[model samples]
Target: MSRQVKGVVSMRKGAPVELRTVVVPDPGPGEVTVDVKACGVCHTDFHYREGGINDDFPFLLGHEAAGVVAEVGPGVSNVAPGDYVVLNWRAVCGLCRACRRGRPWYCFDTANATQKMTLEDGTELSPALGIGAFLETTLVAAGQCTKVDPAAPPEVAGLLGCGVMAGLGAATNTGEVGRGDSVAVIGCGGVGGAAIAGARLAGAARIIAVDLDDRKLELATTLGATHTVNSGRTDAVTAIQELTGGFGADVVIDAVGRPETWKQAFYARDLAGTVVLVGVPTPEMTLEIPLLDVFGRGGKLKSSWYGDCLPERDFPMLIDLYLQGRLPLETFVSEKIALTDVEAAFEAMKRGDVLRSVVML
Candidate 1:
């Protein structure tokens, strides 16, 4: 049987999302239906609204979410009904070449629901990141639901589905920040702040946060930043070098996804220090850096796709840490709004008023 539920939809480009009846079909083979509990309003959702992701009109926005499995279809066994789970976009296929090489995080084949969710009028909806979570109930691939500690609040746990995980992975996994190392994260927003927290978790002795906004810089301190630099008022690279004993940081993370920020991250690192770019850039954006400088750096320059994270391996462990109070995942939830307020939350995000405004369904 099909189910009709209220969902936030981007009907057209640059138009406000509409709350309309979404027709969700029963789960098919390898699929599962989820009862969404909470979802975060991320910038990516806004990008989808603006047709930045694609011209896939009437996109079912919201990907960072937590929920419980309501039903599972044939061949689904990783999760069951009534199980608490964090929704993840990366549902890695074990047979992929990356998985065959023992690196499932870079799996080329991820899964999504074979059937599409649509409007009452039968218009197919393009789910955001293959997990349309702003609705009361959503259908997704069974592998997309990763079982986690149910004790963690959905509002906090859902954040791991995207931005938070990206930042933490940027520092811990991609950048390989180590004990007593000096680290600098450019852009003190949600993702950058998480990188600071991750650096702290990794035992970084000095963590410098560089951002244009003073409020975000201040927030970074609570997230474990040892120093703050207002990039708008100062040269970020120079300040980072000055703070790191004139040697530059051991790890520099570019979370802003801008050419200028990338350059700063490149120059702000010590020789052979890792530079991790976790921020997403637009298609037309380009960088013009000298090949000689790239060669002289002599360190890893890498792009972090979804923070190089494997949801099944990382989500449960992260949730356990959150419950233990070691990881302050709750700090990322700046506000909790009703599902109807997602559009307003987008405005707040645009104005830099909150780290995250989650929608409680």
Candidate 2:
């Protein structure tokens, strides 16, 4: 039987999302249905609303979520009904070349529900990140649901599904930020802040946070930054260099993803130091840098996809840390909202007012 539930959907480009009846079909083979407890409003959801992601109209726009398995289809054994799980976009297929190489984090074949969720009129809807979580119930590939510690609150645990995981992974996994190293993170948004926290967890000797907004820089400090640089008022590269005793940081993370920020990250690192780019850039933007500089940098320049996260490993470890008070995941939940408030939450994100405004379903 099909289920009708309320969901936040983007019907057209640049239009506000509307709460409408979303039709979810019963799970098919290897699929599971989630009873969404909480879903966070992320900038990617806003991008989908603006048609920045694609022409996939009527997108079901929430991905960062924590929920329980309400039902499972035939042949599904990864999770069962009543199990608490954190939804992940990357449902790795073990047979993929990337997985075959023992790097499942770079899984070339991720999974999603084979069937589509739609409207009453039968218009097929694209789920954001292949896990449309803003609805009361959503269907996904069984592998997308990774069971985590049930003791943590949904509002906090759900963030590991995306931004938070991205930042932490950029630093810990992609950048290889190490103990006693000097690290600087450009752009103190949710992802950047998480990078700072990750650096702290890695025992970085110094952590510098750069941001255009003072409020964001201040918040970054609470996460683990040793120093804050207001790029709006200072030359970011020079400031970072000065803070690092003129040697530059050992690792610099470009969480902003803009060309200028990337340039700063490229120049603000020591020779052979890593520069991690975790931010999502638009297709129209072009990066033009001197070829000689790239050769001279002589270090790893990498991009982090989903923070190079293996959901089964990272999510559980992070949830355990959060429960133990070692990781302060609570700071990321700026507000709790209803499904209808997603459009407004987008505005708050645009204005840099909230890290996340999660929908409690």
Candidate 3:
């Protein structure tokens, strides 16, 4: 049977989202229907509203979410009804070449629910990042539901579904930040702040946070940033180099996703150190760095796709750490709002007012 539930939807470009009846179908083979408990309002959701992501109007606009499995279809054994899980967009297909190479994080064939969710009029809605989570109930691939410690609050745990996971994974998985290492993160928003926390978790001796916003830089301190630099008032690369005894940091992460920030990340790292770009850039944005400089850097320049994360492996472990107080995942939840307030949350996000304004379903 199909279920009708309320969901926040972007009906048109540059317009406010509408709360409308969403027709959610019963799970099919390899699918699961989730009772969403909480979902975070992220910048990506706003991008979709502005037609920045694509012309996929009427998009179900939430992805960072945590919920319980309300039902599972045939052939779905990884998760069961009543299991608490963090929803991930990356549902790795085991038969992919990346999976065959034992690198499932880079799996080329990620999966989504075979069936589509629709409006009351039968218009198909594109779920944000393939996990439309703003609704009361959502259908997704069974593999997208990664079971975690149920003790963690859904508001805090859901963040791992996207931004937080991206930042932390950028440091731990892509940047390889390790014990006694010097790490620098540019952009002190949710993702950058998580990178700072991840660096702390990885035991980085000195973690420098660079951002244009003083407020965000201040928040970065609480997230384990050893030093903060207001990039607006100072040169980020010079400050990072000076902070690391004029040698530059071992790892520099550009969480802002702008060309200027990427260049700063490149120049702010020491010779042979890693530069990780975890930020999302628009299609038209281009880089014009000299080839000579790229050769002279003699280090790794990499783009972090979803933080190179494997949900099944990382989500459970991260939830456990959060429960143990080793990871302060709760700090990322700046405020909690009802689903109706998601439109306002987008404005707050634009003004840099909150790290994450989660919607409690």
Candidate 4:
């Protein structure tokens, strides 16, 4: 049977989201219905509101979420009702070419609900990142729900579903930050801060954080940054190089994802060091650099798609680490807001007042 649930929706471009009664259908085969417990407000959700992601109107706009399984469709054996889960945007399909090659993180065909969640008028809504959890309840492919320890608070664990995972994976998976390595992360927002934490977890000898905001830099320090650089008042590249004995860092991550920040990351790394881009950029942005510079750098320049994370493998492990009091997952939850306060959260996000304003359902 189809059920009615309240959800935050972006009806059109530049319009504020509405809490409307969305009709969520019962899960079909290989799908499940989740009772969303907590969902975080992320920049990507705001991007959907401003039409930056695409012209997918009436989008259900939250994806960084954790919840409990309420119902499971026939043939769904991966999860059962009452299981706590972290929703993942990437639900790897085993038969994809990428999966065939044993790299499911880059799986070309990820999973989503075959049926659509709709409005009272039957207008289909695009679930943000295909695992929308802005609603009281949501439907997703069974593979999209990764079960984890239920003892972890929903707000903290849900962050691992998106931004936190992106930053953490960017350092551990893409940047390959290792013990004794010097790593620098630019942009000290949730993603960058988590990158700093990830570098620390990976045993980075020196973790330098670069950001324009002094407040964010302060937060970065608490999250394990050994050094902080306020780029607004100094040359970040030079500052990083000087801090790392004039040789630059072993791995530099560009979490701001702009041409200028990308350039700084490119120039702020040691010879043959890796540069990872974890930030999301708009479609119209263009990058220009000397052709020889790319070759002369002689290091890897890569982009992280969902931090190259495999949800099933990473979520439970992160939750375990959080339970062990090692990951400090609670640091990411800036504030808890009601579902109606999503608009206000967006404003706070714009002013850089909060890392994540989560909605507790």
Candidate 5:
């Protein structure tokens, strides 16, 4: 049966989001309908509205979400009705080239809901990250709904669906942080702080948090950063080097994604050490580095797309860790807001007032 759901919609580029009732078609094949309990406002949502990600409009914004699986389509066996699950953007296709190579985490072709949700006017809505959840419910590929420990709050587990997971994956998965390794993460926001926490969880010897704001830096310390660098006051590259015994950290994560921060991350790592670019930069900005430096640096320079994560592999494991009291994933939430407060929350984010403003339905 078809369903109607109330969702937040961006009618046009650079315009305010409108809350309206949308028509959600019943899942067709390999899809599931999720009764979204909580969704987080992410920068990607803003980017979609600003036309940075694509020109697809009007968009159904909001992706980071957790919910109860209310229905599943034919051929779906990963989840069942009434399962408490986290909604993930990436639904790995086991047959993708990346998957064929045995690295499912790099799955090249992901899946989404086969049925389209549309506005009242019958205009098709492009879901933000393909799992729009700033609504009563949303539809996604069944594989995107990963069943985790049902005891965890939807608000907390939902965050692991996006930014939080990206940050943690940047450190633990892409960066491959290990015991006795020294790491530095630039931009102490939600994703960056998660990298710090992941570094600690992986038993990194030193974790350096870099940011202009002292408040965020303080939060980084709470997230297991061993040292803090106020980049606004001091040279970030120099600070990282000094903190890591003058050789620079083994891994330097650029969570800010600006050309400036990317450069800082490049030089803030030791020779042959990795520099993980988890931050998203605007298209207008360009990165420039000397060819000699590229050759001289024997290590890898890679970009992390959703932390190169495969939802099926990581989501449940992380939730179990979170439930065990080992991972303080909940610390990333700054405030819980209603759906209507998303606009104001975006303003607060622009002013650097909060880490994340989650919409608790």
Candidate 6:
């Protein structure tokens, strides 16, 4: 049977989203209905509302979420009703060339539900990242749900679904940051801080966090940064290089996704050190580096998409670390908010007042 679920919707571009009743059809052959318990208000959500991602107006926003599997369609073997799960964007298609090459993380194709949750008038609503969870319940492809430790709190677990996970994966997975390595992260937002924490968890000897805000620097310290550099007052590359004996860090992640910061990350790393780009940059921006420098920089220049995460493989392992206190996932939750409070949370994020504002549905 179909159900009427309340969800936050973006009716048009650059307009305030509204809470409305969305009709969710029963789980199809390979879909599940999640009773979303909590979701985080990510910058991506705001971007979607601003029509930054695409012209999918009437989008069902909010993706960072944890929930209970309320129902599953037939042939669902991985999850069942009542399983606590963290929703992930990548539902790998085993047939993709990347998967065939044994790199499932780079799977060229992923899957979401074949069905669509539509508006009251039956107009199809595009879901942000194909897993909208800002409402009481959301429907998605069963594969998009990754079951994690049941004991984990919604606020903390939900973060693993998106930004937090992305940062962690960028360091540990994409950059291949290793033990006793010196790592520098630009932009101490939720994603950057997660990279710091992930670097620590991966046994990095020194983790340097670079940001423009003091508050964010303090939070980065709490997340396991060995040092903090407020770039607003200093040359970031020189500062990072000085911190690392003028050789720069072993790995530098550009989480701010701007040309200036990416350049900093480029110049602030040791020879052949990895430079990981996890920040989302807009089309209006273009970067140009000296050809000689680009040729002389004998290192990996990589971009991290969703941290190159394999949700089914990474989420549970992270939840285990979070539960054991080896990972400080809880620190990412700056505040717990209600659905209606998302707008305010965005404001808080803009002022650098909070690390993350999780919407407890």
Q: Tens digits of per-residue lDDT for model 6 on 1-361?
A: 8899888888998877888899899999999999999999998998888888888789998999999999999889889999999999999989988999999899888989889998889989899999988889899998899999989999999999899989999999999999999999999999999999999999999999999999999999999999999999999999999999989999999999999999999999999889999989876789999988877979899999999999988999999998888998889888998888877777898888888999998
Report, for every candidate in turn, its global Cα lDDT versus the true structure. Answer: 0.93, 0.93, 0.95, 0.95, 0.91, 0.92
Error of 6 at 327 (Å): 0.8
Evaluate model 5: give its TM-score.
0.98
lDDT, candidate 4, 17-105, per-residue tens: 99999999999999999999999999999999999999989899899999999999999999999999999999999998999999999
Model with the higher TM-score, candidate 2 or 5: 2
Flag clash pairs in model 1: none
Q: Write the per-residue lDDT of candidate 1 for residues 285-353, one digit (tens) a residue.
A: 899999999998898999988888999888998888888889998889999998789899999999999
RMSD list, candidates in order: 0.8, 0.7, 0.8, 0.6, 0.9, 0.9
TM-scores of all predicted structures: 0.99, 0.99, 0.99, 0.99, 0.98, 0.98
Weakest ten-residue segment in model 2 by summed lDDT: 277-286
Clash tally for model 2? 0
After superposition, the stretches of candidate 4 with alpha carbons farther than 4 Å from their true spots are none
Instruction: Report residue 138 deviation for candidate 4 (angstroms).
Output: 0.3
After superposition, which runs of candidate 5 have C-alpha atoms over 4 Å from their true positions? none
Compute the lDDT for candidate 4.
Answer: 0.95
RMSD of 1: 0.8
Pairs with backbone N, CA or C atoms under 3 Å apart (clashes), candidate 2: none
Determine which window of 10 residues in candidate 6 has minimal summed lDDT: 338-347
Q: List the residue pairs that clash in candidate 6.
A: none
